[model samples]
Target: MSLFYLLAVILIASAIFTITQKSPVYSVVGLLVNFLALAALYFTLNAEFLGVIQIVIYSGAILMLFVFVIALLSSGVGPFRAGPNRLPRIAAPALLTTLVAFGFLIFGIAQRPFGPLPPHRPTSFLGNVGDPNVFGSVGDFGVALFTVQLLPFEVTAFILMVAVIGVVLIAGDAVPQPTLGRHRPQKRAAEREPILKAPAP
Candidate 1:
């Protein structure tokens, strides 16, 4: 229980830190910390598969992709220009959507108020629906992911792909055409030069 509370605090703090930072690199670091804390929270909930996914997929892969994109955009090859503020125009609609979602969340919580925690069960309990040995085992999670949550899973992948592309489109305009063209031939020639000069075996 205490551990859960600690993890929750860490999660909240890291989330706030992630959003409030001015620097994108700092924000990414904070988000990485948030992901770690959320994974710890999943483990405390006995969802090992979720915890692992949170770490491996979100932290290891997606977050690293974000870092890589930031690094690529920040490379001194071109000036980083700020894009138009799309958020200001969408603020009203976004606020309304958030409020509606919050209302629904509150209604659901009221419908099933959390009661006291049940007595601790033994570690050997095989009470999951699909898997008998563990509640959040990889097999059970895979079955649920494919059978029940496939749409959301695919949507998530699509969203990530779109986000990466959008980031590139937004910031990729900074690179001058002449610089890119010059670098490409140099890089290609450098690649071939080493091979061309190699002694025949």
Candidate 2:
């Protein structure tokens, strides 16, 4: 219980730091810590598969992507602040969203009956949907994803595929020349084309 509380504190603190930090790199690091703390909390709850997935998918893959984007955008080795925030407009929406989410979490926790969890054992996904042993385990998640949510899963995959293709198209060197901004080495006055104007008729 003490370990759980400790992990929970770290998770909340890191999560707060992730949002409040001025530096993008620091924010990413805080988020990584937050993810690890969440994984540890899952381990305490006996959800080993969830913990592994949290570490592998979120901390490993997602955080790596964030770091890569940070590196790509950063001019300096340390603390390159990110994008447009003329009035820090996102801060308002972010704060409101966090408050709503926190309210939901508090309400849910208050409504939930707290008690010690029962002992677990290995069981197949096929039987006993009511008291399934596969619950909280990776196999159950896989079964749910591949079975009940199959259509949504396929749609999500297709959307992701389209997104990747769009990124490739945007990043490739063969961008259309017409839309590009004109640069220096100005054309000589004689060489420049004159616009034809109709005399008032």
Candidate 3:
């Protein structure tokens, strides 16, 4: 559909924007746009619960956390320094792995007969779009999340927690500077050099 194509374009453009920005703030803004567009795509697919979760959890919570981290890092004494690059060391292996994955994907697709996709509406499991009781409804999603998919749900939550913890640990005290409510004494004016010493006459 035209709507799907439009959303797909937006998704791809925003994704590219997110990665190509020089400023992290701009990148985050682009990422937020990408998330919103993804949620819209989910809505088009009738996955309302997923759309809402994508917006609420990823856009609301995770994005805000990233912004807070960026702000905290910016509050330090100087611009944050980056670690050594290992891209050169891993580039060849990464390219080989990608090619192997693509080969598998192509082989798998070749095995399946191409045919028209089934109609989207009035499915056996999901039911009609207007139905009060449907697979993608909040109640159903909750039930499934808590029952058959409980392990995956818990594992995802655990991974998110670990990611948050890792961010906190890595962002901690990379520079020796005062944090909230903690101040270091400044050097005396006499002990410090002048910003511009008077030129010798």
Provide the RMSD of all predictions against the true structure, rounded to 1 decimal: 10.7, 9.3, 8.6
Q: What is the full ranking by lDDT, best candidate first?
A: 3, 1, 2
Misplaced by over 4 Å in model 2 are: 76-84, 100-131, 170-201
Which candidate number maximizes TM-score? 3
lDDT tens readout by residue for model 1, 24-134 = 999999999999999988787677988999999999999989988898788844456768988879989988998999999999988986666545532422234475445
Q: What lDDT tens digits, residue by residue, belong to model 3 across residues 1-201? A: 899999999999999899778799999999999999999988877778989999999999999999988987878735567679887899899889989999999999999888775665423243332343364767766766677678988999999999999998887856556586667678898998879878899
Residue-pair clashes per prediction, in order, are: 0, 0, 0
Q: After superposition, how far is residue 21 of candidate 3 from its true place, in Å?
A: 1.8
lDDT of each: 0.80, 0.80, 0.82
Q: Highest lDDT: give the candidate number.
A: 3
> How displaced is residue 90 in candidate 3, in Å?
4.8
lDDT tens digits by residue: candidate 2, 59-160? 999999999888877756543565675557777897799899999999999998877645664433334433365465666666767777789889999999
Which one wins by TM-score: 2 or 3? 3
Residue 59 accuracy (lDDT) in model 1: 95
TM-score of each: 0.62, 0.61, 0.64
Ranking under TM-score, best-scoring first? 3, 1, 2
